[model samples]
Target: MADDIVFDLLHSEIINYALEQTKTTNGSKEVDLSVVEYIGFAAGYKIMERLTREWPRFKDELDTMKFICTDFWTCIYKKQIDNLRTNHQGVYVLQDNAFRFLTNFSNGHQYLEYAPRYVAYTCGLIRGGLANLCINSIVTAEVQSMPSCKFHIHVQRT
Candidate 1:
């Protein structure tokens, strides 16, 4: 419990600092977000590895992706995803009406512009988690407002 809190603090600080540095150095939000996503990727990969040890071996790629969207999402956010949609062709959308991390902030309109930073970290987490399952994919985050976020996962064609 205590460790989780500490890690959360550390994660927030690290992402913020990284974002600032990337913005100042390259002035690119995409790059800054990618750096943040990399952080998530590292964490997701490890967490998924550990999780796989206890979970049943998946027979379908879609099932594995759902596990990440539901079980993994809950583990990180304390709640399951609100909605999940898939095209059955490797495109998935996970929507969280009250994303836990974003819910903590009470920022008004100005916050929308900065929402991507937080969303990027989450996008990275999803991508990293999927990658560990041998499903190479790209994750992008869209925030319509505070506490509401959509994560788009596109599985790569190989």
Candidate 2:
């Protein structure tokens, strides 16, 4: 519980600060999202380094990604991912019905506007995790409402 709170606080502050900085710099939502994602990417790389040091090596690309969906997501959010789907063609979707960072987010009118920031951060985290495992991929996040987010991952088929 304490860790969860700290994570929430730090995530919120980072996102808010990034948005503010982006506004002053490029004033583009896309730019802000990129900035946040970059931060997540760095974090994801560090996390993967720490988590994988003692774990068994991944068997394949899918296994590494599955680790992100299950182990990585759980470690950060304190909950397993709600759903994982793949076409076995390098495309994957991981859904979380109650994503931690957005659980208490309730901006009502600004919900649509503000939700993307958090989602983008998550996308970066997933992308970074995959990248750390040597899987080049594009990850994206979409939200239908607060605490409900879907992450889409696309790995380059080797």
Candidate 3:
């Protein structure tokens, strides 16, 4: 309980710090969260290295995605993804009905505009984790409403 709150607070502070750095560096109204995302990417890559050290090799792409939706997510957010959808064509969607970061605030559309900032890190986290596993992908988050966020992963087949 208390640990979750502390984690949430730290995450919020990190986002705000990244946003401020971006604004200062760009010197304009433009919002660039690449730095924040990259931070997540590095973290995710390293974490994945540790997490998978003892695990068996994944059989397929779907197996990898399942690991992300369950173990990876649980390690970071303390909850397994609520749902995962795929087209079986190199695209996957991971949904969390009560996204940890967003749940700290309103449950509705009150902070919808700022949802992207909260999710940018997570987007990169997913991408980096996949990259570490040798899966090239672009991860993005969609927030149609508050507290519930969907992450779309597009695998780039080369």
Clashes of each: 0, 0, 0
Worst 10 residues of 1 by lDDT: 101-110
Candidate 3 lDDT over residue span 1-158, tens digit each: 89778978888899889889888888998888898899889988888999998889999999999999889899899999999999999999999999999988979999788899999999989988999999999999999988999999999998
- Root-mean-square deviation (CA) per prediction: 2.4, 2.2, 1.0
In terms of TM-score, how similar is model 1 to the real structure?
0.87
* Selected candidate, larger TM-score, 1 vs 3: 3
Task: Residues 1-158, candidate 2: write the lDDT tens digits.
Answer: 67559878888898888878878887665545688898888888778889888879789877877788777887888888999899999899898888887777663334766788777777888778778888889988887766678888888766
Model 1 lDDT at residue 36: 77
Candidate 3 residue 54 C-alpha distance from true site, Å: 2.4
Whole-model alpha-carbon lDDT for candidate 2: 0.80
- The candidates, ranked best first by lDDT, are 3, 1, 2
The per-residue C-alpha lDDT of model 1 at residue 42 equals 91
Best-first order by TM-score: 3, 2, 1
The candidate with the higher lDDT, 1 or 3, is 3
Candidate 2 matches the true fold with a TM-score of 0.89
Alpha carbon lDDT of each predicted model: 0.81, 0.80, 0.91
